[model samples]
Target: MNPILQARNDMLGQMEQMRELSAAPIRPAAQIDGAVAEAGVGNAFEDALRAVDAQQHQASAAMAAVDSGQSDDLAGAMIESQKASVSFSALLQVRNKLSSAFDEIMSMPL
Candidate 1:
């Protein structure tokens, strides 16, 4: 099988996983002492960060396996590496957008 095709398939699988994760129902926030508690968005974002970290670790493990001769699938390792890189880049973009929005809100006149 071509490496490019395999990579594309892997990417599509990852996108499907992301879609499932996003489709999960968000738990309602609780009221505490007249203040609303944290919503599910925070948990969702944290879960996404954890998922990206897990992908990075998985990619590293794949590369290590290839290096130690425990695995002969260099192409698979490369695909995992690419997937991790893309996920990290996406997370960074989200963080940047959130930061800019925060800054913009702070600059608004009362």
Candidate 2:
């Protein structure tokens, strides 16, 4: 089997796992206490940042593995690399928007 196809299959397997995770029912925000809910929202952003960092590491490792002949899944490596790039770009955009919003709020007349 082609390594590219195998890498695609691996990615599909991961997607299925993600789908399974998404299948879990989400708890409504109203169900939680106000302070706890707010804290969770803050932690969620931190968690997302950590997740992006972890994915970036994984992508880097994948590329290294391919380069070193430790892995033959070039397509998988490239896909992971792109995922990391996209995630970083998204995070950057979010940061930019947040900064703009903060600046706008600060400049408002009392």
Candidate 3:
């Protein structure tokens, strides 16, 4: 596997392991499949929004700490801020493309 894919799988495994340690029950594969079938793209978009919000909150907290002299990690704050920016940009692009596609389909002659 490519490095990126390998790293993602590794991260997922670690997350599952953490959940197991914490006693948070992992969803069964069949239940997860059913939930996805029900919510589809909407659930995925909600997850993305939440992830971006969490990143923004984290960046804000990091910057606050730096400003208050509670923490000196300027580089970590900057990285968090950039990650939030990039995720928002990607979501915006996806929305624009979907909008364009919908418009095109509506404008097509029957």
> Taking the tens digit of each residue's C-alpha lDDT, what string does model 2 give over 31-83?
54444455554587688899999999999999999999999888889888999
- lDDT for predicted candidate 2 compared with the true structure: 0.86
Query: TM-score for every candidate vs. truth?
Result: 0.68, 0.69, 0.64
What is the Cα-based lDDT of residue 92 in candidate 1?
93
Tens-place lDDT per residue, model 3, 33-71, is: 675454567777778788888888988898899899998
Best by lDDT: 1
TM-score of 1: 0.68
Separately for all candidates shown, the number of backbone clashes (residues 3 or more apart, or on different chains) is 0, 0, 0
Better of 2 and 3 by TM-score: 2
The candidates, ranked best first by TM-score, are 2, 1, 3
User: Which candidate order results from sorting by lDDT in descending order?
Assistant: 1, 2, 3
Tens-digit per-residue lDDT, 3-108, candidate 1:
7897788879999999996898765444333567555767878989999999999999999999999998999899889999999999999989888998999999
* Over 4 Å off, model 3: 1-37
Query: Model 1 misses residue 43 by how many Å?
Result: 2.0
> Candidate 1 overall Cα lDDT vs. reference?
0.89
Q: What is the C-alpha local distance difference test score of each model?
A: 0.89, 0.86, 0.79
